[model samples]
Structure formats: C-alpha cells, structure tokens
Target: MSRSKWTNIIFLIVILLLIIPQTRLPIQVALHKLITKVNSIRVLEEDNSVRITDTNWQLKSEKGLLKNLNQSEGKVIVINFWATWCAPCIAEMPSLQSLYDAYNNKVDFLFITTDDFKKVSYFKNKNEYSFPVYQPYSQPPNVLMTKSIPRTVVINAEGEIVIDESGAVDWFSEKVQSELNKLLK
Candidate 1:
C-alpha cells in the first residue's frame, strides 16, 4: 500500500476506536500518560508565585475525620485536585503515588477529590496506591482554586505556591524531588 493510503487507514482506525467508549478510554489514558512522561512540572518564579492568604480550609479524610489545612502551616504541602473519571488524573496517579511514597513523611500530601470516599477507596485499592486521599469539606483558598481536574499545587513551608500545574505531569521526576528538598530546607 502507498504511504498516503496507509496513513488514511490508520486515521480511520483511530477514529473508529475513539467512537467506542471502552476502547476510547484506554487510548485517551495512554496518550495522557505519554504526555506526562515527557513533561515535568514547572515551578513558578518567586515573582510569579502566589501566596496562600488562608490556611483555614477544611478537608474530610477518607476515614471520615475532618482536618484543617491550618494544621499544615509552616510545612510543605502537595494538594492535588483530581477525579476518578478523569483520564489525565488516572494517568498521572502512579507518579503521584511514587512521589507520595518518598515524601509522605516529610511533606503533607493531600489527594483531594470530589468523588465519594467509597469510590475513591475502590480506585485506590484497585491501583494499589496508598496515598492519602481527602474530600474538600469547604472551599479551598482562592490561590488553590481551579476550574479543572488533575490540578496540582505545591506550597512551600513559607506558604508560597511554588508550583501550580493544571494537567498531568511526571510527579516523580528529579526536578520535583529537588524542589521538594529545597522547600524542606
């Protein structure tokens, strides 16, 4: 077959695959994962960074306990807003889990989602991820507000939003580790 014919055939196959829900999801997740593998989260410059004016946000733990963000004041915090149905969120979860494994003790990691705890728990168990997940009990601070899922924000001990990313990224990258270490010190 000619190159153009082969290209047209491949394009048609992709289109047909996307028309089916079952096949579409996996393809979308795979594409998202590929994007994340190549992309590293970028830290905002000091001037461009936003400061959290309030730490009074409330979060409900997976265990049904209410926790205050104020408790993490003066500590490095990783807050990810994601949903179980979000393909990009699912794609980046493994990297987030790896990052959590390495920094859970030293940093505050909050995998915030709007999904019911039951569903979130099922997803976590199925993926064998042990990261702490929470539901927002109240409105998050304005600086942390986002209109999209899979948004992640990293706040330093000094309360500066150093990293605010709105899509999937390799959370376990060397740059992320270095940034977290710097924030810790």
Candidate 2:
C-alpha cells in the first residue's frame, strides 16, 4: 500500500475508535494527558489575580461531613472543579493525586464536583485517590464558579488567586510544585 493510503487507513481507524463509547473515553483521556505535557500552568500576576473575599461557600465531604470554605482561610488551598464523567478531569486525576499526596498536610485540597456522592466515592476508591472530594452544598463565590470541568484554582494564604487554570493540567509538574512551595513560604 502507498504511504497516503496507509495514512488514510490510520485516520479511519481513529475515527472509528472515537465513535465507540468505551474506546472513546480512554482515547480522549490519553490525548489530554499528552497535551498537558506541553501545556504549562502559569501563576498570574498579583495585580491581575482575583481575591477570594467571600468565604461563605459550603460543601459536603465524601464522608458525609458538611464543611465550610471558611475553614481554609489563611491557608493555601487547591480547589478543583471536576466531574466524574469528564474525560479531561479523569486525565488529570493522577497528577492531582500526586500533588495532593505531597501537599495534603501543608495545603487544603478541595476536589469539588456536582456529580452524585455515590459515584464520586466509587471513582475515588477505584482510582485509589486519597484527595478529599466534595459536592457544593451551596453556591460558591463567583470567582470559584466555572462553566467547565477540571477547572483548578490555587489560592495563597492571603486569599489571592495565584493560579487559575481550566481543562487538563499536570499538577505534579515541577513548575506547579515550585509555585506551591513559594506560596507555602
């Protein structure tokens, strides 16, 4: 077969794979993980960043505990808005898990989702992720609200948003670690 013909065949195969539900999810997640390798998450400048002044946010933990966002005030927080069915969110879970493992004691990590608690608990256990998962019990402040999944915001102790990134990201990357370390200090 000619090279062009081979390319066409490969493209057709990919299209077919994407059309299949079971195969499509994993393929999309893999593609997103690949994308994160090249896409770096940056910290925003102080003047350009938004302060999280409203701490009235309410969330329920996976363990059935009601938690208030105000509890994290004066502490570094990594808040991620994600859903169980989101491919990009699944893709970034490993990196987020790794980050949580390293900073759990020093930083407050909130993995917020609108999905059912049962499904979220199952997913967390299946993936062996130890990060705390929460469902928004009440509306969050405007700064914490997003239309998309896998939206992550890192806020320093002073309540300023340092890194607000959407979509998939390698949370365990050195650049992210360096930024978090700076915030911790």
Candidate 3:
C-alpha cells in the first residue's frame, strides 16, 4: 500500500477502536454489569453501624407541633429530609412511600421538604402524596438546620436520632428494614 493509504488505514483503525466501545451495545452492557458488580462488592464490605445521636433539635412540619415526632414512641420513625429540586430525592420518594405503606402503623414516616412552603405545597398537591410535608422558616429548627437535602435521620421509638446520613439511601433495603425491626423490638 502507498504511504498515504497506509496512514488513512491506521487513522480509521484508531477511530474504530475509540468509537466501538461507545457505540457497541455489548460493550456498554458489559461495562454496566462490571459497575454493578463492583458496587455490590463495595456494599457487602460496608459497616452496619446505625449512627445515632442525642442532639436536641426541632423542625417545622405543616402539621404544626414538631413534638409530634417525639410522640411516636415505640415505633420506628424514618425522617427523610428532601427537596423537589433534588432528582435523587424525587426518585427515592416512591420507594419511601411504598415502605411507609408497608409499615404505616408500625413506623412513622415523615417526609420533610426544605423548599419553600409554596413550592412544597404545589409539589405535594400535584403529586397527591399523603406524606407529611414540612418547610422550615429562614431559621430552620435545630434538628433540620443541616440544610442538606436527601438527608435521612432514622429515629427510634424513643425519639432518639438513629441513622443520620446525608444522601439518597434505599429506604426499602433489607439492611434498613432489619435495623428498624431491631428498634421496634
């Protein structure tokens, strides 16, 4: 082959090498499978500690008294702090709702929204979600002052803050259910 033809062939080969991985369905599937496997392995190696604290704080729920959270004695209270703008928060809400339905009487599922009361009302009205929605004023209650959406604070029946994590977590996970069961007992 002439030098120019050879160069053109090499360029085409390089382009194919780069484009094939992105364009090929099998390659994408394999990559997704690998990622899933890696994530599962990491989760298996995670610690199972239920982080809790005695921090005294309050939050403003549309339902009035913040003390209502304290009233759910002897029940597992899953306090999920989220906002409408957060995609993960919106994604995990349905799962949270399902979990709530499963344990409605056994657990107190409080879905707290940190967005403006107007926005929260609009979103809740639009979605027709029956979960208790709350909005903290300019100065949120101490318990919810963290200002981080998608933070879930699991509290035991005794009103003690259990697992306080700042991210979207699978509320219906076996691990979480198991922990809640322990507290219920």
Candidate 4:
C-alpha cells in the first residue's frame, strides 16, 4: 500500500473511533495492557542491578495511626496508586491480588488510594481485595506524585524505581514472577 493511502486509512479509523467512543476504549485499554505486559518483561532486571537514594516518603496517619511504608526496607516493595472509581484500576486489581498472594511473604504490596476513606474501605471489602490500603498522609515524594494513575511503582531493597508506568498491568504474569524472584534473592 502507498504511504498516503495508509495514512488516510489510519486517519479514518481514528475519526471513527472518536465518533463512537465505546468501540475504541476497550481496544485502547487492551492495547495498553498488552504493551505494559510486553514492556515489563523486556525491562525486567534484578534488584541489585539498580539503586537510588532513599526517598524517605511517609504516609499520612489516620486516626493517629501510621503505615509502615518503610517496613520492607530490605525487601521488594510494590506500590500501586489507584482509586475506587477508576475502571482501569478496578479491572487490574485481580491481577495485583494474584501477584500479592504469590509474593506476599517476600514482598510488600501497598494499594494507595487518593479517594475518600470510607469509599476505599467499602470498595476493598466489596471487592475482597486483601492488599494493605492507605492514602497519602502528606505529599509523597515527587516521584510518587503524578497526574495520572493507576501508576504502579516497584522499588527494590535498594530503593530504586525498578518499573514505573501508568496503565493497567498484569502483575501475575510468569515473567513478572521471574523478575520479582530476582529481587527477593
């Protein structure tokens, strides 16, 4: 096909996708998930291979209580930024849950929400998601704060951002397990 013809075909598809919102969203979401999975595997590396200075980010307390974001200081830490109302976030929770179940003993998983406390609690209960949930008590480190979510950040024992991306990802994939296993070692 000629380059001009291909460009016009692509433009028409995009226009149609925009005109009919429902048709394109699912395809876009599927593409995002696939890209996330593929890129995650391509970039997987051992924890010891990377390091960064301590961010020293603390979670805000609720009812005079605080969370131990630092508890897994010497272990793999997976923090997911999500909200109850976010469809993509909800769609990816099951995979996150599976990932947590497999590595709960070796890695720390935190599902940090920026939604109302009651809503989060109810959503968690309703969904039967068991990962520890919290909202930022104060402003998080700049690296953690972003305009878009469900951004997931993986920090190794040495505190490096192993994988930082914004999209719904399949956390329980075998390749992901292979990568996390290296971090645990």
Instruction: State each model's C-alpha RMSD to the native.
Output: 1.0, 0.8, 8.9, 5.1
lDDT of 2 by residue, 22-42 (tens): 999999999998988887898
Instruction: Write down the lDDT that model 3 would get.
Output: 0.62
Task: Compose the digit string of candidate 1's lDDT tens values, residues 1-185.
Answer: 89999999999999999999999888999999999988888889999988888999999999999999999999999999999989999999999999999999999999999998889999999999999889999998888888998999999998999999988899999999999999999
Tell me the deviation in Å of residue 123 in model 1: 0.8
Error of 2 at 74 (Å): 0.3
Which sections of candidate 4 miss by over 4 Å?
A: 1-52, 60-64
Q: Rate the local accuracy (lDDT) of all candidates.
A: 0.93, 0.94, 0.62, 0.74
lDDT of 4 by residue, 1-185 (tens): 99999999999988888679676655655665665555443443564334545456666432436765665577788889988766567667888999988889888887788688778778778979777777787667666777887888888887787877677777788877887888788
| Candidate 1 residue pairs in backbone clash | none
TM-score of each: 0.96, 0.98, 0.59, 0.72
Clash count in backbone of candidate 2: 0
For residue 150, give model 3's deviation from the true position in Å: 0.8
Superpose all Cα atoms of candidate 3 onto the true structure and report the RMSD in Å to 1 decimal: 8.9
Q: Tens digit of lDDT per residue, candidate 3, span 1-185?
A: 89999999998876686588544443443443343233311121125533233333455777565644434556677778788776556656665776777788888777776578788778778876667775543443466456666777776665556677665456666766777777788
For model 2, the stretches where C-alpha displacement exceeds 4 angstroms are: none
Sequence-dependent TM-score of model 2: 0.98
